[model samples]
Structure formats: structure tokens, C-alpha cells
Target: RLSNVLKRFARRHPDVALTLRTATSAEVSDLIRRGEATIGLRYDRDRSRDLDCEVLFAEPLGVVCAPDHPLAGRRVGKLADLRDERWIAFPEVPGRREITASHVFALFLTHGLGEVAWTPVDSLTAQKRLVEAGLGIALLSQSNAAEELGSSRIATIRVGDLAASHEVVAVTRHGGFLSAASRRLLDILRADFTKARGTNASRRNGVRRA
Candidate 1:
């Protein structure tokens, strides 16, 4: 998605040229801080003292289970209700997983749910597959759940009153100057997400209406 945004920017501003490099959120932040990459797209909490950040969107998180799981048809309820389910989660070493696990743990702590049994997986796709196999439940961004939900391969249960979310943001070095190309790329990304956010909001609202 970030690369696509950059490509759109290059197309719009033909005179500008940028070398885009992709990395994990932490790697991107490190590259920007070390003056390697001019700008980065990462989660808001990953922002460091050496970087300045502009939040693009706040993405709601959801709990997913196999279609026939007991939680599938339940009304949105407390986060505690999820404590007993087997959980497929990302390994702790990845930057994204660190952020996600922290939030999940916070929810457990906040609700006095204690520790939950979770199995570490390599990627979101793997986690999804595990959930689809009825091996465990998993937490996912709504975007990642779209295809499965549409196919009835998985079902999502909202965590009532536990509205966990993550912010997507654009980051640059705190005092660094942006080249014309970098600035143009940032503009394109901001516009792309703004349009996407609106479209997604509309689609979700439409589904609710149905």
C-alpha cells in the first residue's frame, strides 16, 4: 500500500524521483533515524523521539474465530469472554506483533482476565489459517478479516467496550528536511489513505444497515 502511494506520487509529480525501500515498522523507523530512508509509514506508537509523526488513520481491531466456533454468534461482549479461547498470535519479536500483543495484554490486565493461552505464529495469514482450522481464535485488523468474513470462512465477534485500535502514520526524522520527492510521496500517501478511510467507513456502515 505504501509503495502504491509512492508510485502514484511519482506519476503525479514526474519531475520527482524517489528510491522506495520497504521494511518492518522498526526497521523503517531505524532507517529514517539513521538518514537512510527519507520517510516511513508505521504504527503511531512506533514513533520515536528522533522522528515526527502524522497519524493517517485509526484502524479498529477485531477478534476472529472459525465460523462454527461458539463465539461466532454471540453479541458483542466483554474482553474477558475471550480469555478461555485458544489464541493464535504473532511471535513477540516482530515490531507489529509487539504493538499488538501489548494491547491484547493490556485488555487482559484491565479486565482482570489473567493470562490467556496463546500460540505464536509467523504471519497473519498463518494465524488466519489456524483460526479457519478451528485451532484457535485470533485478533486481527478488520481489513485482514475482509476476505474470510466475506467467504464465511471465519466469523468476527466484537469486544464490547474494549475498543482497541492502532493508528497508521507517516514518519520522518524530527528535524530532517524532506526533499521535494519525499514531500510529494507523503502527500500522495495522505490522500490515498484519506480516500480509503472514507470508502471503508461507507462500506462498513452499509453492511451494518443490511
Candidate 2:
């Protein structure tokens, strides 16, 4: 999504010298805090006092499975319904370190779930591939996997009693000024996010009705 936003910005400001840096979420926050980067994008629900953040969008984050999984086409009534199921999880522990924090694990704890059975992987694509191979169910951002869900290669498992979700935030140093170029880029990003959010909401509603 950041790539999409940058493409538009580059087309309009062809002469602007733009540098793109990719890093772990912790590193991105640090870059903004130290004034190394004017803006950064991160996905998480946590708030930081050292930076100002504009929420791009927040949507239900849920489980997903391969099309052949027994629960693929089913809507679960509670988290406990799948407590014994295996998961594809991140290779980190929540609250141990900011860089290693796992929002998925935090969600599990929030639901009073005990230690879960999982296979850890650091790559999102790899995790999804594992799910496609029927290794285990994985946590997924509904909007991120729209294409797969639409094609029926993957199915979202919505828990009726769970309200877990995360937000994508545009962040910059607190009380800092954004250059005219950065401000223009942010405006474009916000507009694009609004359009995407509406589309995602419609898709979610349609799936529920089916």
C-alpha cells in the first residue's frame, strides 16, 4: 500500500529527491524519533508518546486457513472453538522487546487462551504459503488477503465473540513540521486509505451475508 502511495507521489513530483527506507517497525519508529525520516508507516495498535500518528485504518484481524481445511468455510462462534488447532506464528514473544513484540500473541492472551501449538516463521509470505500447504491456520489482515479470499484459495474465519483488530498508522516526530512535499504525500495517502477502507468494509459485509 505504501508502494502504491509512493508511485502516485513520484508521478506528480518527478523532480523531487525521495529516499525510501525499509526496516523493522521498531527501526522505523526510531528513525522518525531521531529525525532521520520525515515519515514512516507502521501497523500495530500500540501508541507512542515520542511520535504523532494518524490512523490510516483499523479492521478486524482474524484467522485464515487453506481452502481444504476443515474450518475453512465456517464462522467460529468463539476463540476456544479452535483452541486445539495448530497455528503459524511469529518467532517472537510479546513485551519481551519492542522489536520482537507479537500482536497476534497479545490477542491470544487477551482472550484468556493458554500457550498455543504453532510453527514459527518470520516471513508473511512464507506463513501464508504454509497455510496454503495445510500446515496450520494463520493470523491475517482481511484486506491484505482479499484476492486469495475472493478466489477461494484461502478462507477467513471470523470469530463471533472476538473483536481483535489493528491499525495502520502514519507517523512522524511529535510536534514536528512536515515539509510541503511530505504534507502532499500524506494527503494522497489518507485519501487512498479512505477509498480502500470503504471497499474492504463492503467486502466484509458481503462475506457475512453469504
Candidate 3:
């Protein structure tokens, strides 16, 4: 989503050197903490104490399944309603934060559903493929599954009590110096998110971030 904005920034600042790296949120936070990167953007709340975080947006998440699945198109009112359903799990990388998995488990625990069943898949694409094959449902960000939902390839199963979401944030070392270019990029990101929030509020009666 920020691809266009990044391209524009590069074009506008031809003399400035920019390097983009994609990694897990934990790894990104570590890079910034160690002075390897000036700034980082990621999903989920940062647990690192050495960085400052600015939440840019909140993305709603939902249970998703193949269009032909039994629970497809259904709004689950309780987590218990899904206790018997099989799930496609995202493998938790050791020593790293697994926000989605943790959130899903927490929701289950809240409703007294103990140790739900799942088949683990490490890759997001593979997980989606498994869901497409009607293997199992998976929890996913609505935005990430928008295309599939629109095409009827998959459907979001809304759990009334499951208000699952993640905050997208820009992070920087708490006590570190931010180069002028990094500050400028961060400013552009904040401005872009502000504009998005206003546009969303007008169209949806709420800001993009909940």
C-alpha cells in the first residue's frame, strides 16, 4: 500500500539514498535498536522497550474460509461456535512475536475454548491456498483478504465478539538520532495516514484506525 508513496518519495528526492528491507516486526525493531536502520514500519504493537512507536492505522481482522465451506458467509456470534472447526495456523517463529496467533489464542481462551485444533503452514500464500482448498479456516486481516472476499473465493466469518485488529506503526529508536531524510520520510508517512483517516471517516463514518 505504501509502494506508491515510496516511489514518489524516491522520485522527489533523487539525491537521497534510500534502502528498503522487509522482515518480521521483531527483526525490524531489533535493526532499529541496533542502529542498523533509522526507521521501521510494521503491524502489531511493539513490545520492545527501546523504540518509540506511532500507530498509523488499525486493520480489522476476521476468520476466513473457502467460499464453499460450511461456515462461509456466516457471522459467528461466539468463539465457542468455532470450537469444533479446524484452523490453518501460521507457524510461530521461535523467539519472535507472533501477533496474529497470540491474538487468536487469546480470543479462544477468553471464551473457555481450550487448545483448538490446527494444521500449521509457515507461508501466508500456502495458508491461503489451503483455505482455498477447503482444508480449514484461518484468521486474517480483512484488507489482506479483500480480493479473495470480493471474488467469492473466500468469505470473512465475522465473530460479533471477536473485534480482532492490529495497529500499523512506524518505529524508531527511543534515544537515537534520526537523519533528516528519515525524518522527512516519517513525516510523509504520518501525513499519508492522516489523509487516509479523514477519507475513511467521511466514507465509513469512522477513521481507518479503530
Candidate achieving the largest lDDT: 3
- Residues 98-165, model 1: lDDT tens digits: 34555667778888778888888767788899999999988787777888999999998777767777
- Pairs in clash, predicted candidate 3: none
Clashing pairs in 1: none
Backbone clash tally (model 1): 0
lDDT-superior candidate, 2 or 3: 3
TM-score of every candidate: 0.76, 0.75, 0.80
For each candidate in the order shown, give its overall lDDT on alpha carbons: 0.77, 0.77, 0.79
lDDT of 3 at 50: 83
Worst 10 residues of 1 by lDDT: 94-103
lDDT of 3 at 155: 78
Model 3, range 1-210, lDDT digits (tens) per residue? 588669878988889988889887778888888899898887766866888999987766789998887778888788788888888876677645444455567789987788778887777778788899898889887666777878888877778777766778899999889878788888889888777667755665743554
> What TM-score, to 2 decimals, does candidate 3 have?
0.80
User: Model 2: per-residue lDDT, tens digit, 23-81?
Assistant: 65667788898899998877753367888888898756778999888888889898888
- What's model 2's TM-score? 0.75
How close to the true structure is residue 80 of candidate 2, measured as C-alpha lDDT?
81
